[model samples]
Target: MKNDTPKVFKSIFALFVVAIFMIGLFYAFVSMPKGWGVNVNNRVSRLYILKNVRTATRLLDSGKFFAKGMKPLRAEVPYKPIKFKKTANLEDGAANVVTSIVVDYRGFDTLGEVTVLFLAASGVMMLLFGKRVKPKRKKTEPSLIMYVGTRIAFAVIFLFGIYIFVHGHLTPGGGFPGGAVIASGILGLFLGRNGYTPNHAGLKVFESLSGIAFVIIGLIGLFSVKSFLANFLPTGIIGNLYSAGFISLIYIAIGMKVGSELAAVVDSMIGDTKEEWS
Candidate 1:
């Protein structure tokens, strides 16, 4: 009876704690500013910010064109649209507005996507967990020309991936595609050799550091500008290499993180897990 009493008390205490936590969570959500769920389709700010339209019916519903006292202009007022190759010294000045939107405006969403991918990879690794066993039969090794060609191809593919992400703000491709390309190169390396496995410790360290750098950059924006993942750096001339400020930096971090993570996934899947059950 005494032992059962303690167990019952513990269960009740845990339930009480959980109830308090739920209440706090509800309050926190309710405290958020009204209009947080504003419809994206109705907002003129996003369209104008991207500079896709030469003329707009209205100004941004929120945000400073240059000052805060200015409220969003109604349709009656003429809103000056940004010109390509002409608009310099604008905030989030990537020539490719899509990149600006992805890495700047919707950065938190990007982080969530990365997190989801991480979770998926972790799940895969956990499901495939087992002791690696060498095959009883000797596998045929790759030919010399095939091995040499794969190494050369991997180097080219790897560099192309780096180039894609590095120039993400100026081009069509970004971190996700760039990382996938790099992973494809790593896959090539695996095919080149019968017994090739990437360094697990190195991949883990690289992935952790990349994720940390991403969060740190976001924190810097949050502290400096009072907005998470806000553009805090000076945006240079449009269409220039260094124009996009931290958007490029964020993409680089994302590229590294996604690349390392996918590489780790590949390693986990391909490692010898087949063991003869006695």
Candidate 2:
């Protein structure tokens, strides 16, 4: 005998909202200009690929566009082509062009990405904030073989994560992936045992220091070269391990920050532990 009017109204309202959203999305898709972001000949894209962003900027500011019919094309910038394992002392000397873009050309965007991740992790911790205590029912401890195997595996996984971030400038993997790999290892640790609690205090300290290090590195670049996150240090040969200047250092900071933050998030989600960040 109960009325279903309220339920019907809610369903209708939800459908109406969804329809409106879909309509908007469809309109946006149809309105987008053809070949919106796929233009490889765009000036920004060209500069990014050329690794001569600084020179390009100066040239453009002096009214010298690279294309025809733009201020007489001032003096042509004789940019040497990049060669792997042969190029040396180039600007942003990262062998991996993507690394150069992410950490050097678009570093501000990368910082924002890290900040967003930090905020998400902080939200999880805040929502799950409470004193840790054992649950009424205890989880069964892991088997001996599982525990031993996971322990050994965790070491290798952790080391591999470090290597990924450290050699980010020379490889496809970077701080984000490296941190994710390390977090996966931490997750394995959780599965490797029952009632395993990570060092909450140490994690907090480590996360804070990593973020601070990233900011300090950017500030040093700002003061030294009047550009935030500039490659102020010496960029060695492109293929060398010590190349890419501060890009390597920044990736290290980002890896540590993301790894610790994600580990903390995982710890918070696996609540009912006896650890406090004190």
Candidate 3:
């Protein structure tokens, strides 16, 4: 006799996958896009606060202790700090203030950014890494309804994900947000159908290729300019998706890199094994 778990698990997964398709469809077709804006420009300035004392003679005269008490807060800043250098701006190539700042002035922050993406990918993969793998010949009884539905569902999901990342140049969603949407959709397939595994071979190709493209873009910058991610391409019109030139290209690569890796992880964790209900 065959195990009955695939029948039960398949129903659960089908519902889950359908739900993701609904959400992605709603976001892609119904929601309005928001305009791009940068964070507030923060600069250091001397702030003098005068407090009232009842008597002049009762005042504390120790400048050392007063400055010392607040020593930890002191930046020891230069007399003047330049807020704008005529180098890179969102107008220069990138649309995002955070990305421009992190990727340009402080590239170490971009390393941390990539590291965060890596962490998210790792956490997702880790969730199912410890589950028991199925025997090669284990019989599965997944429903045809769920299986066919998820196959179509994932196709919509993958396209929407690509749209999100591609339009990230002009709109609100970028690689991170887009990739997350894609992962959510991929997760649905895992939930809906047992034995219907995601295409790991294709996903691995996506991950590896996107990673190579990102590194090559950075290397291209290095070959020409002073830094690793220097802007060398023609700057298109400001605020246009295709206009930002290299910035748009870079974000798309990053989106592909992130979305594929995360999807692969989601696919892996959702196994075709039987789950015992409590």
Candidate 4:
């Protein structure tokens, strides 16, 4: 009864706080400048309409399907399709704008998101599964074809993942996809082998080092450029293999961290299953 009383009080207090927050938010919104929410000129829609018209006019006049170096006709448009098209390549050195946006513009947010993912994975492992136990099982060797095929596939998949992350600045794929691919490759090995146990120490070391490297790189950026995860290194030529400066480096770190973390998760799940079976 005493415990229930405290819980009831806590719930009531929480509801009160939420109500106060909502009232404050409503007041703030209503207190804003007049016509702030309404779109009079509708700049965004106008820009889109203008762009389409201009493109169609160019095609009709020149009798060509493609228009090269087509600049925005409107000087006072509120929104531009490519926000930093002119300076993105020069500033971030990434051929892909998505890479520039993720690693250069909103890097701190990405770091927080990655941290959250890692924490969620850890929490799931710890809370859902209390302790890990090794279950004794009959020793059985995998088929010759299965063993050989998995070995070859593992190497290829891992290398491909590395390639994806390394070329993230110039390509469509990035750290997250590459890391997932690598983790999937590792998972393949676990499924193929009977008593394959992932090296927890090695994975931990890789995860720790990559995480530390990411922080160190961010710290370096902070010290040099006065911003966290700022592009401190030289931005090489765009569309080149060795370009994008810190963006590629950060992607590499992210790939390693995510890959190791996911691999650890798979190992934990597998261990839990083994314990349950025993």
Top candidate by lDDT: 2
RMSD of each: 10.8, 4.0, 15.6, 11.9
Off by over 4 Å in 4: 1-89, 128-132, 136-141, 273-278
lDDT digits (tens) for residues 1-278 of candidate 2? 38556878899999999999999999998866567556555445566676777787787777656566654232355467998888887877888888899999889999999999999999998878878887565557679999999899999999999999999999889999999999999999999888788898999998999999999999999999998988799998888999989999999999999999999999999876553664
The lDDT values for all models are: 0.82, 0.86, 0.61, 0.77
The worst-scoring run of ten residues by lDDT in candidate 3 lies at 47-56
Number of backbone-clashing residue pairs for each candidate, in the order shown: 0, 0, 3, 0
Q: What TM-score does structure 3 among the candidates reach?
A: 0.57
lDDT of 1 at 1: 75
lDDT of 4 by residue, 1-278 (tens): 75466778899999999999999999998966566576534343442322233444455477443343445433333332433234343545787766777787778989998999889888867755654555667477778788779889999999999999999988899999999999999998987877688888999899999999999999999999898888887776667777768988999999999999999888777764423422
Residue 204 lDDT in candidate 4: 88
Compared to the true structure, candidate 1 yields what TM-score? Answer: 0.73
Please provide TM-scores, in order, for all candidate models, with all chains considered together: 0.73, 0.83, 0.57, 0.66
Better of 1 and 4 by TM-score: 1
Candidate 4's C-alpha lDDT?
Answer: 0.77
lDDT of 3 by residue, 20-125 (tens): 9999988886555445342111221121101011111132343332454555332322222213322233324445544444344444465467767777877876
lDDT of 4 at 243: 70
lDDT at 137, model 2: 57
